[model samples]
Target chain A: MIRALISRIKQGYRTYPFPKKEPVLPERFNGRPVLNHDKCDNCRACEKACPTGAITSQDNKVCIDMGKCLFCGDCTSACPKGVIEFSKDYRLAANIRKDLLVSDKEIKLAQAIDKQSRRIFGRSLKLRQVSAGGCNACEADTNVLTTLTFDLGRFGIQFVASPRHADGILVTGPVTENMRLALKKTYDAIPSPKFVIAVGACAISGGPYIGHTETSNGANGIVPVDLYIPGCPPHPYTILDGLVTFLGRR
Target chain B: MSRQLISIYNNKSTDIGAVPNLPIDDFRETVINSVNTGRRIAAFFGLPHDNDSLKLIIVLADDHQSILHLASTCVKEKYPSLTPDCPQAHWFEREIAEQFGIRPEGHPWLKPIRFHHSYTNNDVWNRSANETILPCVTDFFRVEGSEIHEVAVGPVHAGIIEPGHFRFQCNGENVLHLEISLGYQHRGIERQMTTAPQNRLIHYMETAAGDTTIGHTMAHCYIFEGLASCSAAARAQVLRGIALELERLANHTGDLGALAGDVGYLPTSSFCGRIRGDFLNMTAILCGNRFGRNFMRPGGTAYDIEKSHIDDLRKRLNAALKDVTNAANCLWSTPSVLGRFEDTGILNKQICSQLGIVGPPARACGFDRDCRYNFPSGIFQFKQMPVATWDSGDVFARAYVRWLEIQHSVAFILDLLDSIPAGNIQNKISAMSPCKIAVSLVEGWRGEICHVAVTDNSGKLARYKIVDPSFHNWMGLAVALRNQQISDFPLCNKSFNLSYCGHDL
Candidate 1:
């Protein structure tokens, strides 16, 4: 018993130092969504794949409503161009709701500028996450971003749990009937000027559960989403890029 | 003679014909004949092939490995029930009765299992026909006694544990009977999975049960692989095996800590909890998720394991495992912890076999059943892994078995990591064909998790059935709880750690 006690004391605090020193994240943490219009065929597969209808095509252009997106990564896998990817950047706090909506034109323009900047130099960004009917996969990846390894916060990105405090709501899962009220409630609760980031295919086009009478596919059915992250559950790095794009840090 | 008769009946099937064209009276006779023949009972799922009436499909698995699909059309007024001979079909029949408003003609117990008082009756059933039913009763199976006193605990507990309710009927120190009520954390996962599209449904599959994410995903993926006849990469299979073993290690560590905590051995409990947390952190480092969610896809894994991640995992595993071993050794040396657990909650070998309990709970009681070792999947078939078993059939035996398995899991993880091959992580398949039904069985932390998936011609999910380990082992808990003292309940309960949400679904 004495030896055990001694051993525990010697172990010396393994807890992550959150809110002080930034926690390290994993290599491919699923944090937020970003779109690469250059590679995109604009098939709107991401929009169709979103569980919540977060992505919508208006006049041959894609628009994302971030408010109702869930980060399940269905859209990432559905994208043939590998255009839609998850970025590890997660600083998605916004003061205005309208700022969350990202159109195809805006994304295309951002990608053009980002390519030129990357050619000259190199830069990355931060991301914010929100969970919608997720089994905690998206949440887990978001949390891993702060571990001792990745230290995503070092890149000026942080995951704020509340929509009010968050820059963008990283959404996951096909919004269930039960979670619909909570999703709407969360959107309503978020202060105006918030950006919605739809992470994972479930949030993009209801990746797997689309066209079922039981649930809604993408965020557009409920709220306007800004970015779409596509993947069954988008990798952390893909999420990071999405956040960086949203923040205009890359 | 009786066994032979049952086997014979289980093997032989008398197919009646197309369900829609069958006469109602002839269908009832077919049902009786099938039940009397002793065919392996399967679930009754509603099929809406016709708009005017719903067809009730009964899947019967014969000993010959052939599945017989028996269907009967039900018009609300004149539906036939078959629960009379097949007592095991009670749950399914009641489910169909409540969900589709199709009255099962002579069911002894026809009560609502999933809906609330507000959403009761035929109209509600017709509106939400495909929604998976959930258990609604706040309190099920209440024990009655005059001045015997009863204690109702949980739905929410003081500790950071999943929610479940425990109702104890006791006379001072001795417990007359203990009733468990669950479903507080019902997220309606199965209902969500049914409507989900083919390409992205794996997310729901991974999260169907948190602790058993790998086990569930593997089972789901296996079903899809078999249905599509798509072979996953060998490297992916080995990696999946590694992830599964890691999951087993984490859950076993947590269970051991919880079991130790139940016995008032705080040192062992704290040590085990810390080790479990470390394992979870290791998982986070490796897969970017503590529960190993999103690590698995239909054909293979989502990402490849990098060398640095592997190195990190090995280092952390070595340190954490050392602590765990030392803590377990100390506990074993101490007599108090052992004395309280050794003979408590004894479930004899015979009782275990009769109830069809699987995994550690069964193995601890000398059943020698394990899906990884016996049923063999992925890397388990190629590798040499030990099956931990104990004949004592007591709580101590159960705890010891878990500890031993944890040791095995750590070793397995190490072996797997050392031998992991470099290759592509995923494969592509694009066949949308009918007659696509596949079943996968994985040994979860608790026991065997069986997932069966049926796909339509359009490659959409026709029906998905997941039988969690808890479903088979819950009855075993009730059997063990018999005649034990009230004080021993916590230890007994902890030994099982059954997921109510998994079972309730």
Candidate 2:
């Protein structure tokens, strides 16, 4: 017991003061990607190098779909004129799917739910996390929020085990066909006035597994997603930001 | 009289014709004989040979000699089952029967592994092509007694975990049998690897087992390099090694915390949880992604550590290790935590060997079966880290072995970071040689991660097989549950902490 106490003291208070103070992200962390269309020569090198077809030249404009991007920075390397580079802006979440298409303009970030829904769930939001076919990276990062460093409970947000007790569902995966029925069943089990948040590139736009017969693209057609958080697997801060912002607490 | 198998080293490519081609009967006999002589079955899978035949390939590892043996046979429909004679071939045979439309006749248990349609038009179970297949909806092993009750858990579990179904037959509190039925997380990764766009191949490999991103991607990179008949430079190899060990350190630390959490020990659980993130953050310092995505390429690592970053990594690692030490020591020093861990879910060494388990669970059973030690590749070929083992084969042993590995991995990373050689971080990989087969093994935190690649006549990837450690270790968890208390399921499950999608894929 003494050792535990001593160790607890040595560990100290390690939680980040996000929103109040900017968190320390790594120097190399690539959160949101920016495409410089002025420098692009329509070489199509980025389109070819993209593993998920996230980069494209549409209407004579180069656009990167953050929902489909793995945040791999391959497009940046393929671009000869420095047309593409990922910025350290971690705020990559949206209420609508089309907003995730970053084409030089800033992304209209996620907004809080409607007045009535916010009034009901703004405080003490209980979520049921469903991983349809996630690679566990999304699941792990989302799960990290409950740790001391993130302490999600302080914001009255808790991940409940049963959907019956949840105000919403936060899903991660490409939504494989095998899990389609199960995911639907889970979403249905939650009470009415419930919302769904799709986390990760897989859940938002199927990530790299898009257009596969085995997967249903993502949570789009399976369930109506209230928020979209994009990354190969979004970082913990991104997830927390999405959650609190959707709840009107951020 | 002919050679039964061709010998090859890890991460080495060989001519397809050099592998011995035997008849199905000889192939079965040779595989059984090799297992009897204490060889391990590394990978066994079937690929389409022609419209009518399926070619089965087996890669056996002679760990004592650090050699890999390969052989193949073409079977039109059926092959004699190797599971009856060699228990290690059980899962592989079941997987082959599922993937290809071949029947492994006389097998004790023949059931669908991933609940997906067979690769060929021929259906082994004679299920119609149009009918949609559902997972874990089949008949399971039954124990008939009025007192024996069955408990069914889900594809959607209570926790934030991957999907899988678990059915337990219990006589009151004691479990008689625990059958695990998975495939809910199947995204057809293996199928995609064969047909996906070239650029997407590495992305699929990165998520093959997402938590082991570095490990699985390292295996794919080695396979690609082998097919190209090139190797990563010494500096790149060392960087890859550092990333792999960091992955190991992060996972082991997390597992230890999870094991403690399962036992309701909060102090260590809480501390280790945050520490796990710290280790992951350190990984982000090297690569942009915490899971090390986009850090590995075909020839070498995509990113190289700067000198200042190396010092930063060393300092952070030391700091995290110190905290983890205190957190882990709480597990050992606490009698109540040890009580729940020791003598719980005991899987003896014989069952572990028979089941062909790998990783910490196998090491916990006193088998020094680490791929890094037995099948050296990359930086492992230059430097050595002793295999950590524990003999109890219980949950305590599993947790203890992870702790030992954590210490060793930290030391390895620190030592390597201090002396990272100066060289190029990547090599330009040229066109791969046609009609060649290559095998790459990486000791992922869970266990041995095996990737076998076969290039066709046009230098396209003909077949790619990934054998995640969870594939071999899941059965061990089921067997461990036998005669154990039903309430201890979470504790035992956390100790093994096998991957659902890795197995399903």
Candidate 3:
């Protein structure tokens, strides 16, 4: 125990100063994307290359749904004209599903929830994470949120074991056919005035497994999702920022 | 050496014509005899051939000779089951029956491995086509007595984890039998792989089992490269090797910590958790994704590591290695942790070999089966990490073997960082040859991951089989649970933390 304490003392602090201070992310880390229309021609290369239909071009207008975008950067690489590039800005959470759309109009980041939601779940939010068909990358990042670096507990967000204890449910995976019933049961088990936060491209959209027929497209038809946090598996910081965006808004 | 089976090289595509079609009895005898004679059956599956007949293809790996034996036989309606003789054939046979609706005659304990409608019109188990095959609602092997009790868990677990059901027939805390029911996470991956190597193929490979992104992706790429008769550049192979080792380091470290967590050893658990993230961050340094999703492409790696990147990786790896060593050594150094781990859920080597367990679980039982050493592919062919093993086959053995491998992996990665060759990152991959089968085996962190792809006449995938390490080890977990204390199930489970989706697929 003394050796452990000594080791701990030597290790020092591991938590990052997020929101209060900017994070020094890895050099190659992919976060939020920025689109440049001037470089884009009518070429549908990006649309063709996109695994999920996250990047869609219609009527000479291109839009990227942040909920569906996995941030895999295939669209950026597929575009011969170099139209799309990702920025390090990862604060891409939204309370409303529509707020996640990055279209020709404007990039709509995640806004705060309504006054009623804030008044109820603003102080302490307990989440029951259900991995319907998640590949566990999302699950891993979600788990990472609890670590000292992210410290989600500082914000009064905790992942409880049971749905009865949760204010909302964080759903991952593509909502496979087999898990559809279980997900519904889990959602139903949670009391009224609850929300579901669909994480990752798989939960928001079916991701690469979209057309596979095994997955239920995504979590859309199963339950009412309040927030959409997207990534192939979103970064830990991204998940933290999403939670902060939802719960921190006054 | 065998006359009936046509021998082929690993990662080399064999011509459909070269694989001889034998009689059912002869095919069964060949597979049975070969398995009895020490060679393990790498893959066995039914692919449609010869105008609607189910053509059974068998891949046997002669680890010592580094040769893979391939043979096939056309069977209609039913064929003699080799599972009664060869234990490893049980899962593969059950999978074949589930997928193709084929009846394996005289098979013991045959049931749906993955509950689904068969590709064919005939239903093997004879459930109505329109009815829903409920997951985890199967006939579980029962142990009924005056004092016997049953414990059923998950498909919906308490923790933030994957879904799978476990049924334990217990006699007051002692587990009589453990029946694991999976398929909840199945996304028809093999069915999806039939039309693969597409723009999105790599992503699918990476997500097949999320934790095993590098292992699965590398194996799929090997299958692609093999059929196309292309080898990745030496630099690409080295990068892949580094990625694989780093993945190994991360997972093994995580597992060791998880073992600590299960034992309620908080310090090592907390420290190893952070160190695991450090290793993941190192992988993210290479590719932009922490999971190494885009790192692996068909012909070669999607991303390249620069000198500066290599230097950075070396620094981080060194720091993480120190932290991991400090944290993991606590498991062995502290007597309390060892007390909980040692001789708890012991699986004998004879049972493990009979059941055909792979990866660290097999190594823990002293099987000496590390694919990196035995079946060397890519960078492993040039450089090797020795087989790490322990004789106990207990939780301590499993945890200890991982710590040993983690050290070896860190050393191997550090050494490779210094000496990785410089060349073109990728070889030009042309279209694949038609009517060919190729196998790629990688010793993933979990164990042997075998990916077999059979291309059609038009060079499109007709069939693809992915046998994840979990597919081999889940049953072993069940076998290990026999006569063990039921409360220790979680720790025993953490020791062999098999992938549900990998097995479900």
Candidate 4:
């Protein structure tokens, strides 16, 4: 026991001081993309290059849906005019669906929880996570928050076993057709006044699997979403930041 | 048994016309005889040939000879099943029935693999003609007796894991039988890939099993490159090998930690948990994404390793691996952890080989079935790593094999990082030729990932079949749980770390 303790003590502090101090995101980390309309040639390469229909253009206008973005940086390479470049800014979550679309000057931010929600479940929050049709990347990243490094427990956020104990439903995957009923049942099982947070591009807008008949085009088609965090599988820091932001801690 | 052997080399694509189409019985005998002679089914699926019939294609891998045999036969709505003779084809036969709506008559436990509707109008099970199908609604194997108990756990699990259902028959805490029912996470990946536009194909492959982004992507790229007759750069192959090893390192490290967590060993578990991230972050430094997404482009890699990235990766890998060694060694030394892990969830060599299991779990059972060693491709052809194994065939063996892999993978990556050849990162690939079938097997973190793609007359996909290692190993997990204490299920499960989406796909 002493050896275990001694070994642990020698290892020193492992948790990142995020929100208190800036999160240490690595170099070449794929994050939120920024598009320059002026440089875009309207070639539609990004639309053609994107596996998911996240990039759409009309009348020489270009828009990228964060909810559907995989953050693969395929768009930047496909565009000949250098219209798109992914930035390290990982704050891509939003409360509303329309807020996910980014063009030139529109940068949608996630709004804080309402006063009634804060009053009812302000001190603590519990989540019941379900992966309807995810690739496991989103699930793995979400689970990473519980580790010693991320330590989501310090923020009083816990993933409970059953929906009855959950304050909200944290959903992953593109919500496959087969899982639609189960997603609805899981949502209905949760107590009323509960919110749903869609994590990853799959849960938000089906990610790379948007057009396949198997998916219901993400979590929105089945249930109304309260928060949208985007990435193919959002970085653990990004997920943590999104949770904290939605909780009104930042 | 008297029929002439028809075969093809691994990683080689051949014209579909070159493969002889034997009679149905001949095909069945060929498959059964091959298995009896010690060959494993690499992939077995149906390809839509015409409006009236479908072609049943069988790929058998002879690991000893480093050769793969391919043969096919046309089958109508009903055909004789080979599952009774070759148990390895059990899931594959069920899958053919589910996908092509063909019945493999005479199989003992034949049921819907995914519970999805047939691709064609033909309904194999004759489910009310046009009635809709639901996933996980199936009649499972049951044992009825005094003190008999059944526990059905489902599509929605308590842990933050992929969705799958498992039914267990138990008297007291000992599990008599375990049946895994999946397809909750099925995304119609195969159907989508049949007509997939060239650019979008890699994306589907990358997402086929998200955790296996590198493995699946490599297999898809190999299939396309083989069909298109394009070769990746020498440097690109090395980098791919590096990325593949890195992925194996991250996942194996994580699985070891998870195994420790299941046994409530917090010291090693917590340390490995953090070290796993360090390995993942190293991949992120090489490419733009942590999971190596968009980095494994077809014909080559999407990103190139720079001097800075290589130096940085070396430093992080050395540091992280040192900590990982310390954390993992604690598990072997701790008497309590050893007691819990050893002698639990045992699947001997015979059962493992009979099930056609692959990856570290198979290695734990004293079988040398690693695709990287038996059937070398890409960088594996140029370099080799020793096969890691253990004879115990228990949870401890599984965990030990993973640790062995982690060390080898880290050293392989570090060595490659030092001597990463400088060259072009990508090569242009053309559209595939028509009427040709291609097979690519990748040693994914989970196990052998088999992807078979056949092109139509117009150079479009005629049929695509993916066999994830999890598809074979899930049964191994079930077989291992036989007569095991029900509480040890999690520990056994973590040792395998099978992918639900991969199997469902």
What's the distance in Å from true for residue B261, model 3? Answer: 0.7
Model 3, docking class: medium
Top lDDT: which candidate number?
A: 2
List, for all models, the DockQ compared with the true complex: 0.11, 0.84, 0.68, 0.77
Q: Give chain A TM for each model in order.
A: 0.52, 0.97, 0.94, 0.96
Q: What tens-digit string does per-residue lDDT give for candidate 3 at A1-250?
A: 7777766775568888787887766777777777787777879898888877788876686778777787888898888988888888777777677777775635666777778778888878999998888888898889878767677788888999898998889999999888999999999999988889999988887877886677887898899888888888888888888888888542
Decide which is better by TM-score, 1 or 4. 4
From the highest DockQ down, the ranking of the candidates is 2, 4, 3, 1
Model 3, B337-456: lDDT tens digits are: 999999998998888987878999999998888889888988888887788999999999999999999989999999999998877787889899998889999999999999999999
Fnat, one value per model? 0.10, 0.78, 0.61, 0.74
Tens-place lDDT digits, model 1, residues B366-448: 76567676557778879967889999989988889998998898888888889888889898844634645555667888887
Top DockQ prediction, candidate number: 2
Model 3 spans with C-alpha error above 4 angstroms: none
lDDT of each: 0.62, 0.90, 0.86, 0.87
Task: Encode model 4's per-residue lDDT on A18-130: one tens digit a residue.
Answer: 78888777788877778788887788999988877789996688898888888878788889898888888888888998898888676878987988777666568899999
Candidate 2 Cα outliers beyond 4 Å, as residue runs: none
Candidate 1: list runs displaced more than 4 Å. Answer: A9-12, A34-43, A56-72, A77-85, A90-250, B1-112, B116-135, B138-142, B161-165, B183-194, B456-459, B485-490
Better of 2 and 4 by TM-score: 2
Instruction: Identify the CAPRI category of the predicted complex in candidate 2.
Output: high
